[model samples]
Each structure stands twice: as C-alpha cells, then as structure tokens.
Target: MAETDPKSVQDLTNVVQTLLQQMQDKFQTMSDQIIGRNILTEHSLNNDNAVLKRLKEHQKNPKRVKVHREVYLKRNMKSFTLKRFPQ
Candidate 1:
C-alpha cells in the first residue's frame, strides 16, 4: 500500500550493498580460519558421507568459493570424480 521514493530506494540499495559487503568480509574471515578447515577435515576423516557433499558444493560453484578452494576441491574431487565437475 506504500510507495517508496527515490531517496528511500537509494538508501535501501546502499544498506543492502553494505550488508552484502559485510557478509562477504565475514565469510572471508571464516573461510580463512583454522577452525573451519579443521572442522571440514575432521568431518571428512570421520564421515565418508560428507566428503562428496562438501566437495560438490565447493567445486560445482566457482562464484561461491575463494581461490584456495581449488586446492581443497581437487584434493576432494580426486576421491569422487563422478560426483561433480569443475566449474
């Protein structure tokens, strides 16, 4: 029932951009953490079910991962070549 003015739209856009940037920064930090790797690796070692899922999620989508993801993707992909293709 309410219409947004140009200023309101601009403000909303700025807020969304700011939030996206902050989310990306946080994701970068989390991805860079030893804990994240440790958890994934630990899960990997303990659970065969998770390996393909994680590898597929990381490898099938190039835009979602960091540059270093290639290393892990290859390492995991080697185990399940049929599960996914490289992006």
Candidate 2:
C-alpha cells in the first residue's frame, strides 16, 4: 500500500471541516424551524389572553340550579336501571 502524503491529509481535513460546518448550519436551521412552530408568538399570546378574558367573564355569572324537594312515591319510581361494563 502507498503511504499517504501530508498535502492529501490536509485536503481531507479541510473537506471534513467543510462538511461539519454545513451539517451545523443545517441543524441550526432545523432547530429554528422546530422552535418557531412550537413556541407561541406575540400575536398568538394576545389572542389567547383575549379568549381567556372572555371565558373568565362568562364564568363569573354561572347558572344556578335549585332543587326544592324529593317526593318518594311508588308510582313515580322506575324499577330498572342500566348497568355499565368496562371494556
């Protein structure tokens, strides 16, 4: 086998460095895209806050249910109830 030359080794090193830099740039771009997609932007935050405020206002005046009395009469009661089974 022929012995490798210094100049050839240096060229290989330079090529490896260039490839690593390109990969780093690609990874950075992919990371930026992922972060951008997952994170909420300023406009989205404002819209979310507006929706939450509306929901809070609606919840402030919730409906009330008043149960007056329960009369246990034999004619009004049902004889059977359905049983639920878990899958």
Candidate 3:
C-alpha cells in the first residue's frame, strides 16, 4: 500500500474544518433570522388582538358612541334655523 504524505493529510484536515465552520455560521444566521421574524409576527398578532378587544368593548357599551363633529354641527344648525323660521 502507498503511504499518504503527512503534509497532504494535514491540508485535507484544515479544509474540512473550514468547511464545517462555514456551515455552522450559515446555520446560526438562518436560525436568528427565523426567530426574529417569529418575534415580529407575535407582536403584530398581539397588537391585532388588543385592537379587536377594544373594539368589542366599545361595541358592547351603548353610551360610548362616536359622532363626527362636523355632522353634529350641521344638524344643530339646521335645527336652529328651522326653529327660528317656524316654517
């Protein structure tokens, strides 16, 4: 059997180590990106849930109603003019 040179064997070992390190670094970066996306999605879901809850609570109450100020002013002005003219 032909014996392998010590220098060639050492070079092969170094190449394999470098490749492994590169793979590990890529895997860590992918994992961190996925985790960051998951965290952002979770926060978005939480905000949506809070907004829905507040809307539901607002719907359940009869007195806590919203009216546009412009519409209210127009309506009052009409009523005032009608009362003043009496027609």
Candidate 4:
C-alpha cells in the first residue's frame, strides 16, 4: 500500500467535517419544522374538541318552544285584530 500525504489527509478530514456540519444543520431545520406542525395540529385538535363538547352539550339540553294550539290561535287572533285596527 502506498503512504498517504499529510496535506491530502488533512484536506480530506476538512471536507468530511464540512459535510457532517451541513447534514446536522439540515436535520435541525427539518426537526424544528416537524415540531412546529405538531404543535399547530395539537392546538387545532383541542379547539375542535372544545367545539364538539359544546355541540354535545347543546344537543343534550336543546331549547324547544312548546306552544299549545289554543295559545297559538289566541296569539294569531290578537295579531289579526291589531292588524285590522291598524293601531
């Protein structure tokens, strides 16, 4: 086997260091983006859960207008009478 030159070995080491640093930086950027998206997704899921809870509560106790036919007739008559009188 041939002996390697010291200068060439140093140059090779420097190139490998530079490539490793670039890969580390790229990995850090990707990790930060993934973490950010996860946080946003978690926040959105929480909001959706809150809205679903409110909807379920509303369904459990819904506002219902129970009007008897006689009451409705009386109200209708009164309105008709007022409209006829124009006062």
Candidate 5:
C-alpha cells in the first residue's frame, strides 16, 4: 500500500472543486436558455387569446391589486402559495 502525499491530496481536491463549478455553470446556462425560449414561444401563442393576452400584459406591467386583511402567523410556521403563471 502507498501513502498519498498531503500536497497531492490538496491538488486533487482543488481539481474536483473546479470541475464541479464548471459543470454547475454549464447547467445554469442551458437551463436559462431553455426557459427563455419557452417563455417567448408561450407569449407568441397567447397573443391570440384576448383574456390571456390581457393577463400577460398586466403581469408585464404589474399593478397593485387590492390588499386584503392582514392575518397573524404563529412562530415557526412556514407558509407558501403555489401559483401557476401564464408562460
């Protein structure tokens, strides 16, 4: 059995970290392009639907909707709203 030197181990760790960062950047770029293309296509399609077009336009230029009454939340409580935005 051979013992690994500390410098060699550190170099290997650095290489692995660099490779991981490169992979993450590539994946993020690809995902962004895909999402952008989908949004453009969807907006083009919804141009014909008057109601959908109106909603999209509103989202593009968001106006404040009426604010509802405030509700109290308990400590350590997590809340989330699931909304499907028109593409």
Candidate 6:
C-alpha cells in the first residue's frame, strides 16, 4: 500500500475510491430499504406496545404439540450376471 510507483499508487487509489463508492451505494440502498420497513428497536419494543403484550401472553401460554417421525431404509438383494471389463 506504501509503494513508491506512481502507476501502482494511482491504481491503488482508484481501487480504494471504487470500493468506497460501492460501499456507500450499498449502504444507501440498505438505508432506503429500511426507510419504510416496520422495524422495532430495543427501546421501542421495551415501551408500551402490542408486540410486548403478545410476547407476554405467548410466554404465559406456550403451546405444546407432539411430533412423530417414521423412517425406513431397505436394501434389495441382487444376483449379478454381469462381468467386469478388462482395462
């Protein structure tokens, strides 16, 4: 990164600028995406909200459901009438 070659320095500078621009563009797009999203921050969720009420209710009355799984593996016996080819 501390090379004395002018061409190398210019290339490095260009690459860094391009990378910075790309990162900025990505950050802007991410910010734009979140602009209209219904995201809840920690402070907001801790405040008086319906989501907190629902969460408390869910914790008090958690549902219990039973799950059953069945698996079977079979191997068929085979009689080979085939011969191996010589290399």
lDDT of each: 0.77, 0.64, 0.83, 0.81, 0.65, 0.59
Task: Extract clashing residue pairs from model 2.
Answer: none
Q: Model 6 over residues 1-87: C-alpha lDDT tens digits?
A: 557334777887988888899999999999977864545564566676877786677677655111111111111111122233333
Q: lDDT tens digits, residues 5-45, model 1?
A: 33677878987888899999999898789687898998887
Q: All candidates: CA RMSD in angstroms?
A: 18.6, 10.6, 12.8, 14.1, 14.6, 14.6
- Which runs of model 1 end up more than 4 angstroms from their true locations? 1-7, 35-87
Which is the leading candidate under TM-score? 3
Structural similarity to truth (TM-score) of each candidate: 0.33, 0.46, 0.63, 0.60, 0.47, 0.36
Ranking by lDDT: 3, 4, 1, 5, 2, 6
C-alpha RMSD (angstroms) for model 1 = 18.6
Error of 3 at 61 (Å): 2.6
- Report the candidate with higher lDDT, 2 versus 5: 5
Off by over 4 Å in 5: 1-7, 48-87
Error of 4 at 64 (Å): 10
- What TM-score would candidate 4 get against the native? 0.60
Looking at model 5, report the run of 10 residues with the lowest lDDT sum.
Answer: 64-73
Kindly list the per-residue Cα lDDT of model 3 for residues 1-87, writing each as its tens digit.
144333687877987888899999999999999999999999999999998997787688745635444667889999999999988
Predicted candidate 4 versus true structure: per-residue lDDT over 1-87, tens digit per residue: 144333687877987888899999999999999999999999999999998987787676655223344677899999999999977
**Higher-TM-score candidate among 1 and 6?**
6
Candidate no. 1 TM-score: 0.33
- Of 1 and 3, the candidate ranking higher by lDDT: 3
Error of 3 at 21 (Å): 0.6
Clashing residue pairs in candidate 4 are: none
